[model samples]
Target: MRRTPHCRRAHQEHLGKGTPLSVIICDIDHFKQVNDRHGHLSGDRVIQEVAGLIARQLRAGDPAIRWGGEEFLVVVQASSGVAMGLAERLRSAVEHFHDPEVGQVTLSLGVAEILSGESIEQLLGRADGALYRAKRSGRNCTISAAGN
Candidate 1:
């Protein structure tokens, strides 16, 4: 919560090691509409609920950060395919998440495996692009980084 840069540093140790690292960027679909309809407090509750769902699904050592607002960033030390599976699982969980006040929520996710010799910015940019594609593709779905 201090800053996004601090969160990103947690994974720096494994970079340049040729490890199978991946990133997933998840965004709440139609989040503005939720805020407008349910009020900011409800929006906060929704963010908390979604964050909890994302946290529960992560394995030990993986990092899930509230990137900002209704968006989350997850770093997984796995292949792109594995990351895709994880993203899909998270999306499904959000789709089924039931809240007495907010009802069901959904997530659109973009996932990418870090390539050797790639910087964090490159990795995140790819993931973000994939996330954008997911949002464009109608949300509540996962998209893997193309050609990576």
Candidate 2:
């Protein structure tokens, strides 16, 4: 999907001003197993439902995108603490979400705040690292980037 010019400009503005930005990457736990047990249709439904829940919880300036299958990225114009709070809320929302077909679902999340002069890849890598940590520690939890 094409990102709107406004969104692009906003990103550029952040880059220009060297503003700190926070990002959260979230993924469902055992998503493939859910698909295998409940069928692809049910899996898709769960994904959509979780996406909606995350979207609803976003702040006015925040944006949430479906990064990939069973994965989502949320951008928040706030500090790392705010980003972590948002991630925790999203995790809780998904955990408590009700679906007749899929029942309960859990999520693993990674959060990071962009540092001055940091590249997008670097920020993403930090968040990805945190996400892997969350998964390794045990699914259904939130992990912030190391040293954040």
Estimate, for each residue in 75-132, the C-alpha lDDT of model 1 and write its tens digit. 8877889988999989998998888988888999999987667767888888889999
lDDT value for candidate 1? 0.84
Give the Å shift of residue 42 in candidate 2.
Answer: 0.7
Clashes of each: 0, 0
Provide the lDDT at 71 for model 2.
91
Per-residue lDDT of model 2, residues 1-148, tens digit only: 3343433554676788755578889999999999999999999988899989998898767878788899998877678998898899999998998789878999999999877766667777889999999999899999999858
lDDT of 2: 0.85
Against the hidden reference, what TM-scores do the models get? 0.90, 0.90
Error of 2 at 69 (Å): 0.6
Candidate 1 segments exceeding 4 Å error: 1-16
Tell me how far the alpha carbon of residue 140 in candidate 1 is from the true structure, in angstroms, after superposition: 0.5
Looking at candidate 2, the ten consecutive residues that score lowest on lDDT are 1-10
The lowest-lDDT stretch of 10 consecutive residues in candidate 1 is 1-10
